[model samples]
Target: MNLYPVLQTADVAASARFYRVHFGFAPTFEADWYVSLRHPLAPHAEIALLDSEHPSIPDGYRERARGTLVNIEVDDVDALATRLDAAGVPVVQALRSEAFGQRHVIVRDPGGVLVDVITEIPPSAEYVAAFAPNE
Candidate 1:
């Protein structure tokens, strides 16, 4: 199954622009109250922007309280972070390299969603050896 996350926002157009301008996402579908974006190169990578007032959303979520964290994997986390920094996007968490061979940064989207932008890197030697197959 494919998973397409929907981020409810106060301004659907603004949020759509944010993703498009900063993350290279293109709108596959758009409307007055909703927009669906797909990565320019990766068609399977998708996220939807929905106006908070959209009726399809449950009453509980209409208040704009979302607990989900969106994770986006990129080829270069540092480069994206630099561009985002220049564009005035606030970084929720500083860039850090994980033991599992990933460099990531956390940023808050226009819709108040936490997005973890990650790129795979070489894992620590210890971690690599730990996951090695038995001889």
Candidate 2:
């Protein structure tokens, strides 16, 4: 089974461009009211954007996502951080290395969804035992 989150936004095209330009996602399906995107290297990872006012969504539910975070793991988050800075994208959470095996930065997408860009790193010694062993 495949699962992906759909974000409701005021402008589907602008939201689509946010993912495409900043995160390297390309639209697999595009429509005036919706767009489906996938990263070329990770085809299984997908995200969809829908017009918040689109008729298909129930009237009461046609609002932008709130307090939702989408995490995208990459090979080199520091480099991506530099690129994002160059592009003038604001980083909500400054790039930092975590004890729990992640080097990440957070930014808000056009629709107000928090996007956490991460790169995996070896966990700090004190936190290493907290992770389950790989099967």
Candidate 3:
């Protein structure tokens, strides 16, 4: 499966900084409101933070919040949340224990893309069975 995210943002540089400093992504190409950053350890999609000044997305882009809210599944939600907060990126959803088997935090990017940072927790036997749904 092609599990990559191509997100839309208004501030390419800001988004690039967020990904680069927080997620360890280094940019390969950078232009006005256009950039490509990749993770050295894992496969990451090329994110494009469109410039609001010269928007190519047309009018009424964020009508119903269209586009990918990239879900960043991590191992340490709390730590990451703290880092993001300290970096001045407010968390939309505080780190919470999910009913399933994970902890998650939501944050909005420069272009209003909601990023869900998830950290999986050990699943209970019942939860596992329910998810497995097999005899």
Candidate 3, residues 66-133, lDDT tens digits: the string is 55577778779999999999988868888888767878899977667788888988766657765755
Q: Which lDDT tens digits does candidate 2 get at residues 4-51?
A: 999999988988998999888899999999999998884568999999
Name the candidate, 1 or 2, with the larger lDDT value. Answer: 2
C-alpha TM-scores of all predictions = 0.86, 0.93, 0.76
In TM-score terms, which candidate is top?
Answer: 2
Tens digits of per-residue lDDT, candidate 1, 1-135, equal 888888889889988888899888999999989999999784568999889988898787685536878888898999999988889888989999999888999988888888889998988887887565749
Q: How many backbone clashes does candidate 3 have?
A: 0
lDDT (CA) per prediction: 0.86, 0.91, 0.73
**Rank ordering of all candidates by TM-score, starting from the highest:** 2, 1, 3
Task: Provide the lDDT at 119 for model 3.
Answer: 92
Ranking by lDDT: 2, 1, 3
| Clashing residue pairs in candidate 3 (N, C-alpha, C atoms within 3 angstroms) | none
| TM-score of candidate 1 against the unseen true structure | 0.86
Task: Note the clash tally of each candidate.
Answer: 0, 0, 0
Any runs in candidate 3 off by more than 4 Å, and if so which? Answer: 1-3, 44-46, 52-67, 124-126, 130-135
lDDT at position 12, candidate 2: 89
